[model samples]
Target: MTFFLLRFIFACLLLPCLWTTASAEAVSFPELGSAVPGHGDVTYLDLARMVIPDLAADKDGFFRGSIPIEMRHIAGPDYDGSPPATSGLSSGDVLNIKAGGKDRLAMLLDLGDSPDSAEGYAVLALYDITGKPALLDAVNVAVDRSTYFRDPGKLSIGPGDDVIITTSTHFNSSQGYVIAPLVMVRNDRFELIDMIYTFDENLCTNRRTQNVAFQAIADSQLYAAIKVTVTDATVPGDESCDGQPPPEASSRDISVTYHWDKNASRYVKDSDALDRLADDNAKRF
Candidate 1:
């Protein structure tokens, strides 16, 4: 009888230790100070925990169609100061915007890379006015740099109330390239329609000579124009003299236009419009 009693006491002592170990392993949020350009020492998982309670209510059906309780960082810089050099990065602004005539909250987050890994990602979330939030999109972008959305006003609202957000990876500062993705939210679900790349660079044989431009059309359509120049650099003779240079490069200019297609739910290339623009330029010259 004494032996069985002692065994029961030992089993009770081991149970708590095992439970503690299992809880530690189950933690999903990354530890603080692991990644750069982080969201002011807060992880997206952390934010999700803090806001999950508000996402549902006892009396209402899930969200209840009311604006989220908290919003900040909207119409302001996403993060303050440089990465690595700065210890604490400020979380960007969160704002409430109307999409499809419905109020929604938009926010940006920087999920820093793992301690031993260099990979990181950026997250954009849109919360319905009813307090329910959905992750609109997440991209594989650098966390150490200021790549999150900075201006709340820059979010372009489409005719159907689709939201267009502009983000970039600053791997090459001189190129100043950006990627704009259009997001559609419906029935508490987020969908990505398309992505547009814009940049200006002078390469050896090809160049993006002009910055991409956007215009709003009458039918709730968005228009974009991009200019590129390509050159043929070929030498007539393989043997070259010491003081002589190769043949001068021959170049040609081309312009492309894109229009949002509501039926297709994405942007499509418009060759006819591009040709017309080219003809107009030719007449002016």
Candidate 2:
């Protein structure tokens, strides 16, 4: 009887361990090729699908995927595997950027609207394409549903060329804005240097119709200076509002410049520019 009781206790402990091992073995993740065959065979979408967790096809046949815990750092601390709409991924979702004196691919996945505002967010992953394509690191970034990435060609900044990722937002049928984010490769990782609100515009309303534009010039070897111009006027012949008297016809022009601050790791606008931005934000919100 003593021998039989000992055997039963041992069996119970061993069974749980066996069950845990089997469960772990049952779960598997998609694997990438040991070597990249060719660019045509594999795409950023395929690579994204491999990295993203719990990939499945929706009823409409579009792919759906979730962020994994290991990649949570790329999305943000508060992001909890919220699946982005697969339709958001397009030919423009991936961009080529230079990293570590070699070519790298930057993949952007839209995460939809942020919890705090109507502004959307996204996760950017840098893949080292030297040997076997592998993810270097990822970062959570702010963007819009219709946001797109641009190379901006090359700029003479830092030790090598820098890349600018731009996102645009349409506030309403009549209002829109654009932001340009500068990202650089350093220490084997991609760092966000700054996000510049480069353009904004608003159509006919109680306020004057306005248009703002910015052009970045690499004035120095270390950084770039952004030149901004603003123009606004009240239309005389246009009746955009229903039965409302048009405001007095008036016009104004403003110009401001912003410089890159190395210490602050961002672009710093002059006092006049800062005030203008603050006033604009005050009016928008």
Candidate 3:
């Protein structure tokens, strides 16, 4: 079937990332039913595999920090009551899934409270995973109610122990969609960081297309997190850089994409990965 083949190819592509390691105990998010709670459906590889390097320099590549995330996946199910993964917007709702070690802290991105509807905005919530999860901090970072859906998002690590992400918005009024960079960083206090030109849409007409991915900043000394966005613009804005969209490509309709640039030179996209993920979703059943 198409779905099987797609997963096969995707896994093949990621083969370089896999290694034989001692497998950790597998725990499921029973209530939410995804690898990560509230993230909707996605493949749950072993918790051991889900672990990223620690934020501190002195520690080994594992996050010895309080947060131990058991589940994390860049590609998987779309979490809309579907078994196989599906692409595109499921709801305008922002969810804070249980993450961190032992699900100790539930960091969520709440993107729904718009005048029109919660249609893809941000209302980040950090919760304490008690016997019952307790909402510790609930803050609204950004909102795009006009014609955008902010459902699917990716996570990364920013400088200074910050969490960075890149998410896309599907517009209701425009012809092109938007790709943006957002972050949860601390300044004396924890605050969300929104990059300037994250939108892929024009002030007017962008319809389809989505943006995602947010790789941690490998070199904390040089810059912020590295992002791999999907864009139709062969150069830019067909897929514009965050905050500084190209004038000509600002309002065009296009398909999905995935691209990577080693240097964070204006949000380059890897149309291949995005295209592959979308392609895989279609055949996932």
Please report the TM-score between candidate 2 and the true structure: 0.60
Query: Please, what is the TM-score per model?
Result: 0.43, 0.60, 0.35
CA shift at 136, candidate 2, in angstroms?
Answer: 2.0
Q: Which candidate achieves the best lDDT against the true structure?
A: 2
lDDT of 2 by residue, 161-257 (tens): 4444444343445444544455666655766554545333344534444444445677762566755555555565445667666567787766666
lDDT for each candidate structure: 0.37, 0.49, 0.31
Candidates in order: C-alpha RMSD to true structure? 20.9, 18.4, 16.8
Q: What is the lDDT of residue 269 in candidate 3?
A: 37
**Which 10 consecutive positions of candidate 2 have the poorest summed lDDT?**
19-28
Rank candidates, lDDT, best first. Answer: 2, 1, 3
Q: Quote the positional error of residue 92 for candidate 2 in Å.
A: 4.9
Best by TM-score: 2
Across 139-224, the per-residue lDDT of candidate 1 in tens digits comes to 23333333344223133345335343434333342233334444445554455544444333443333332233333334445422
